[model samples]
Structures are given as structure tokens and as C-alpha cells.
Target: MNTRQSRLDVLHSLRERETRSGYGWALSTDVPPGLQQSLQTAAAQGLVELADREIRAELSAHEGRPVLWAARLSPQGHDVLTYLDASPDPTPNCTPPSADEQVIELRPAQMDALRVYANLGPVLRVAPADGLVERVRTAYFDRPGNRWRMTLTTEQIDSVAYAFYLRALSGSVAEANWFARKYGVTYRVDPATGRPGAVRPRARTVSP
Candidate 1:
């Protein structure tokens, strides 16, 4: 018999062991009992992801039925863990950063909630541009040597969009075209759908 580990414990362990962009620990290998359940629960809530032997969960989703025996912290899980370690920040000014137009629009208070997902997920950073104030670009690193790549899941992206009263999917051409009109927002066509959307480069990652 094995003791049941709390969800927090499992998440912590996962993050410590597998925080990289493309790695996973096999749940069936040396993981504790009930870990698979915990992982599944987290996955259902957009925390951990259950993948096949190779950790190619995304490809399996498009290819066929997946084996899903490996597990790792999802982008949201990383963000959740990261958020727990930090205090809530009040610097968003109730507006999401418009850099790169990649991260989903974060509400004033909720904006800082998921910054961990994409290494601060487009949090507004101010800098000097030719002696003038300027907005920091998404994935911009303070040091050129600190770049560590990371990416968010489509579910994570869509969730943020929907949370801000927008949708990643446009049902009609008119709706797609109208996306550009929101708050003076510009539209970009998602390569997967070729439909206009309010965000772009949905697969880019950020790391500190």
C-alpha cells in the first residue's frame, strides 16, 4: 500500500524533476501510487499533462489514441507554482501588455496571475528607447544570455482569451474580421486555421 500524496506535493515534485520544455517523468516508472490520478486531475484542470511514452502528447492528440503514461507540469502548473512563490503584483495598471500580441489579455487583477506560464507572460516592462520611454516586447529578456525557451498550450491560450471576453475561434468571416476592431486591436491569421485572430505566434514561449 502507498500513501496518498497531496496534489501540491505531486506538483512540486513534478516541477523539480521536469521543468524543461520537452521532458517528462514516466508515471508508471517510479512515481508513487495515486500519482496518476493526481496528474489526471491536474490535467483536467489544465495543470499537469499526461503524455505517451515519448511525451508527445500533442502529436498523439492529432495522430490517434494516446498511451498517456508519462506526466509533467503543464504551463499552467508552472505558473501556479511560480505564483505561489511570489506576492501578487499591482503593476499592471489594469491593462494587459500588448507586446508581441501573443499572450492572452489579462484582466487588471488577473493579469499577473499567470505570468509564470510564459516566464512572466508578457507582463508590462518599461524601458528607455533612444532616450524615450518604450514598452517592452514579449519574450524580451533583460540579459541576452538568459533566454530559456518555453511555450503555452492551446487550452491555456484559449482560456485566457475567453476570460477576457474574446475567443480564439471565430465562427464566421465577419466575426474574424471584427476581432481587429476590439480596443483598437489588430488581427493576425492563425496559421492552423488561417482565420483572423486577436493574437499571434500562439506557440512562442518565454523564460527568465
Candidate 2:
């Protein structure tokens, strides 16, 4: 079994208990040895916390290590689990996106007008391609400031496109417009109307 997979299972079990009992979940001593490492790794990832209490004194005495009793999912952990569970396949590849590609995958249904506070601070809310969500989340949560910099990829574009830098706050979108034009991508803003851009078919006049 994959260590990360086991860790997620453990978290799910604990989370279930918390949901039913209205209390924090504790680690059971009956846990498999293979899961011990996974538990530690989860804790390191801030997904779970280890308790210092001595619930399994006998095991600690026999194993020459302190028994970890309490463990509960952190807020971020909950969000991550929710995100992962919603995926078609929960097993994540966890591969980092290429630095060269800089386009966000937009849902094919409609390219809605998106607003960003700053020219560089826009975050696309659409679903990313396979294995890309986790990487984006990690980079986003790990960093400070409203400025998020990473390569955005979309199914609409080819694989070789590079990533772009985004900033926060809304003002003159000249930079955004320029970037969109530079890459031959469409922006929701119309230069003439100074409003949300829309696609309209060519006007046809009826015979007089």
C-alpha cells in the first residue's frame, strides 16, 4: 500500500469519528506498523498533529518510543482531502508543472469574464488538468502576499506554452490585455466598449 494512501485512509477514519462524536479523533494503538511512518509524514505536512500523552504506555515501553495517541485533521488538511476526494482519481501524481508553460486551463463550456485586483494577481477558478491542482495548491498556500506566480496551462493551448506571473488588486488591466494579446489569447475586456467582452456573430442585414 502506498504510504500516502494509508495516511489519507487514517485521516478519513478519524474524520468520520469526529463527525459522529463531536470530538477530536485519537490514534488507535491497533494501527498497522506501516502506517506509523505515514502518520508521522502527515503530521509533518500539517495534515495531522501528534499528541504527547501516554495512552499506550505498554507499547511505548516495549517499543522504546513514546506512544502517540491523539491525531486530528487540520483545517488545511480537511480542504485538501475534500479537494482530493472530489477528483475522479484520488491518487495524485504530484508532479510539478513545467515552468515554461503559462496558461490556466479554462472550462471549455464558456470563457467567462474574470476579474483580478492587480494585473498579475488573478487566480483562475476553473478545474486544472490532471495532476496540476495539487501543485498549484501547494505553491499557493506555501507562499505569502496576494501575488501568485506560476505557469498556467489550459487544454485550449498546446503543451509548450510557458507560465505567467499574476498580481492582485483591480485597476488598469493594460498589462493583462497586453499579455493576452501577446499570447494570442482572448480577454473578456473589450478595448472599445471598456466592458466585458462577448463573442457575437457577424451582423447580417435582411433584404430591404
Best by lDDT: 2
RMSD of each: 18.9, 11.9
Per-residue C-alpha lDDT of model 1 across residues 1-208, encoded as one tens digit per residue: 2433366677887776554423454434445657667778878988887775455565455446553466777788878778766633323333443442333332323333223222333453511112111221222332344431112234344433332332223233332233334323334556778874446434557886
- lDDT of every model, 2 decimals: 0.46, 0.47
Model 2, 1-208: lDDT tens digits are 8977777796786577546533354445544565556666888988876655553564466547665564567887788789877654423334566665553432211111122211122354432344344334433211233332334554323211112112112333444444455555443545677874322233689999
Q: Clashes in model 1: which pairs?
A: 150-205
In model 2, the runs with Cα more than 4 Å from the true position are 1-10, 17-22, 54-68, 82-199, 203-208
TM value for model 2? 0.37
lDDT against true structure, model 2? 0.47
User: Candidate 1: which stretches are off by over 4 Å?
Assistant: 1-5, 19-22, 53-68, 88-208
